[model samples]
Target: MPVSYIQGFDPQTLREIVDVRHCRERLDELGDQRSLPALLERVWLLKVTGDLDAALAVSEQSVRVARMGGPRKDLLRARVLHATVLQFRGAYAAAVQELTTCGEEAEGQGWAALAAFAYQHRGKVFYDAGDFVNARADFKRALFLRQEAGAPEPELQSTLAAIDAAERRRADVSVAG
Candidate 1:
């Protein structure tokens, strides 16, 4: 996962335009490792590099690996990450549906952190779709869940930033209208 926070995402796009060089560097460092963790990282790297097709393929492989060998929680996490790739590809409806299910399952299993992740990414999808109202609501839910999970300060800060971004965009739309 990228620990470096993305600053100054364009309000219009509601997504950080990742530097392909950085993602490529990470991919190079990842090498040919086929471990589940490596596969997941590759999925993220490919997604950020704007290789949505490759990302989706690797994401499917990740989910299959997790489902076959990992725990249920790991499977859910993989599914969330897969949904994020779908979100980035502009498959908004499919991404939202998958994320909604993941969020519900995580919450039902008392996994607040996982639930937060699901909700936060779903909020990003909503933001990308220009649905600021739903984005803000999901971001707020993610913030609460992160706090409940005792997430690290950086994680909490990320959610806070998301909420602020959504609010800013919402206000912009209202003013322009």
Candidate 2:
């Protein structure tokens, strides 16, 4: 997430807002269950609604829950999502650290889909940092993984678009200078 992304997230309608109101209600109702999906959804909505700190908190809790005998993929997914929250908050170093671990773990486990997902987010973090070269490389890897897994084309298209956008931006900067 970048400054432009935050500016363009001007949600005008209730549905568009993606607030954590309903998520909170669901959490309360499922207190004992601690539904991972619901918790992750709550974190995502909170971040979308501009509550970065709160989202981070829930994300941390999600990781903790995941570490407590949760599935490896769940833990990896939670950590990846948490890194996204960090990215939104401009904590690039932390986000990179988290994403790197998640990506490595996903790859080590041979989780092509999860590895692709991790790479996509990691690429976004690199893009946000203006490290276009690394970003493009990560996106390319993500695209390859998606293709190997037979994932939808939209995701592959998104990775390619990110690479193209970064290349264009870098080129523009070079010519301007």
Candidate 3:
């Protein structure tokens, strides 16, 4: 038998989901390793599993490690992931602030993929805060950046879905008001 796995944020719930088996396998493989890559993966697994506190700690460590010696791109990516953990923890302001800087730096560096990632996550943060306008704007920007970067189909689809969701919510809120 062949097994398949899919992991990402649910469009409706805005909650991240991971293949448990895959997550377990990866975690086991990473056991006790504190390397930057290992720490980043652990942070993602922990965050997806709702272990926000543990994820936050690991993400912070990953950022520190990335800052200490990792390449510039790695440091920016680490910061973006850390900001995501913060977003999940309801630290919207902090998440948005970090993501803004990450997006700017990525764009300045001509890293379209990284800039898209930062914008997409920032959109999620805005959505969680009920700022649908900003969310949709960010999502649209992410979509454009992703396209420019030649991102894979799934990534482009994800951004499109986010944009749709934000647009729908914004329309609903306006109608209700």
Name the best candidate (by TM-score): 3
Error of 2 at 6 (Å): 14
- lDDT, model 1, position 51: 88
Please write out the lDDT profile of model 1 over residues 1-177, one tens digit for every residue.
Answer: 774524445555656666778779888898878788999989988987788998999999999999999998989989999999999889999999999999999999999999999999999999999999999999999999999999999888778888888999999999999
Query: Local distance difference test, per candidate?
Result: 0.89, 0.76, 0.88
Evaluate model 3: give its lDDT. Answer: 0.88
| Candidate 1: stretches off by over 4 Å | 4-19
Instruction: Judge candidate 1 at residue 44 and give its lDDT.
Output: 86
lDDT of 3 at 89: 95
TM-score result, candidate 3: 0.92
Model 3 per-residue lDDT at 101: 100
Best by lDDT: 1
- The superposed Cα distance between candidate 3 and the true structure at residue 27, in angstroms, equals 1.8
Model 3 lDDT per residue over 47-128, tens place: 7767899999999999999999989999998999999999999999999999999999999999999999999999999999
Clashes of 2: 0
TM-score of each: 0.91, 0.81, 0.92
Error of 3 at 43 (Å): 0.5
Whose lDDT is higher: candidate 1's or candidate 2's? 1
Record all residue pairs in model 1 with backbone atoms less than 3 Å apart, i.e. clashing: none
